[model samples]
Target: MTDSGIPVVFIHGLWLHASSWAPWLELFRENGYQPLAPGWPGIPDTVELARADPESIADKGIDDVTRHYAAVIDTLPRKPIIIGHSFGGMIAEKLLGENEGVAAIAIDAAQIKGVLPVPLSSLRATLPVFKNPANRHRAVSLTAEEFRYSFGNAVSPEESDELHRQWTIPAPGKPLFEAATANFSPHSPAAVHTENEERGPLLLIMGGQDHTVPEVITKSTLKQYRGSSAVTDLVEFPDRGHSLTVDSGWRAVADACLDWLRKQNL
Candidate 1:
């Protein structure tokens, strides 16, 4: 098929499905862009089904998720402009390293190999899944309390409750373990090719109050891209948390992204 428009793909992080990108899809489409958001392989079609069979996500690794998204990108007529959050963001970076996209944005991206900073809040946020070694092979779901702490601390209690009730689902455990042990594993899937000269222009967006992937985490990822000739920029929202993409103020984040794309002449 001939490429019809500037294709934009949105990749959601853990605990949420591709449906989380619904609003953004509408927004991007209204702006004359063709947007597609594909979930990790085997993800259920609805939030209820996903929550019902949470364990279905167990044992999925980074390579599996990356390959699924890469295959989707390959179907596009031209390289896409990819955007991702948390683990999804890391996958976007990995794809960009392979020169699979035209440009990319990573929002509150999970730490990949060579990103050494580990903040207290990040550890606390991740402890729910990583504290237990058994969880590495299990699909883990977060409690409302844990979700509030990790994703919605900056939002209202009611909003936090709704976010947990609606979008939260079980996430695979293997990728978390892989990322946690990336430094020790020579063949870690958490690794990314940061120095690839062919990498398209990239941007990293951070939510200042985000506990799961904090400023340090995103900054460390940016630091890893220092030697790259491709453009890499970082933007922070001081009052936002990890849920910035889904919170009430999500449009502000979207606007920033659209603005960045415009600047890139995309």
Candidate 2:
């Protein structure tokens, strides 16, 4: 079957290898869209290799990652529908606001500059990296227990361990540092053009139980887009956590996305 000519790009957040989007790619492809999942700059092609050489992905900040994905979008035949998780979701919003994508779905996205509420759970979820300032220029890996707390808390212990073993990878700490200090910086990379009225539609999905980016943060992110006249919507999965994109219930989230795209006639 021929593709619908519309592209769908999946952006995986930190701690998970880009291959985590494999199922999403297949699903979107079967639904008539051309889908691609590209890794961050310097990310190895495999989880094992990425785990082995964390330095390759170290020290990459938000701007660096955003530019990398923007370059990928430039290579596509049409402006793609961007779907991103965690920091990738932040990148998706930035890209969409800049007109790089036709539309975007930001699921459990990191807090942008204007987002003021930093829940205690969020602080705890990121403590592994924030505990040490020097980590900003390094790569950080989460232990299985930490992964369970931050990404898999809403799922079973066995499934969390399996997910940690299957897709976990060291992630750059620079972006976290940048996002943490966004409000203090005069020109922060974590700042999104939420007021871009000419930008494409946006969807913000929140995992109500997400420790890393709690529900309040997503709600704050929604408020950030209030100045814009563009399409902006929010959905909450109250029982889900940060692992929603790769968990057993991922299909439900993907199907919701597909339904939204169809509604937009994308």
Q: Which candidate is the best by TM-score?
A: 2
Clashing pairs in 2: none
Tens digits of per-residue lDDT, candidate 2, 1-266, equal: 22457998899899999999999999988988999999999999999999999999999999999999999988888889999999999999999989999999999999999999988999999999999999999999999999999999999999999999999999999999999999999899999999999999999999989999999999999999999999999989999999999999999999999999999998
- Measured over all alpha carbons after superposition, the RMSD of each candidate to the real structure, in angstroms, is 1.1, 1.2
By summed lDDT, the worst window of 10 consecutive residues in model 1 runs over 1-10
lDDT score, residue 232, model 1?
96
Question: Any idea what lDDT model 1 has?
Answer: 0.92
lDDT (10s digit) by residue, model 1, range 1-266: 33667999899998877898899999998987899988788788888898899777888999999999999988988899999999999999999999999999999999999999889998899898888899988889999999999999999989998998889889998898899999999999999999998889999999999999989889889999998889999999999999999989999999999999999998
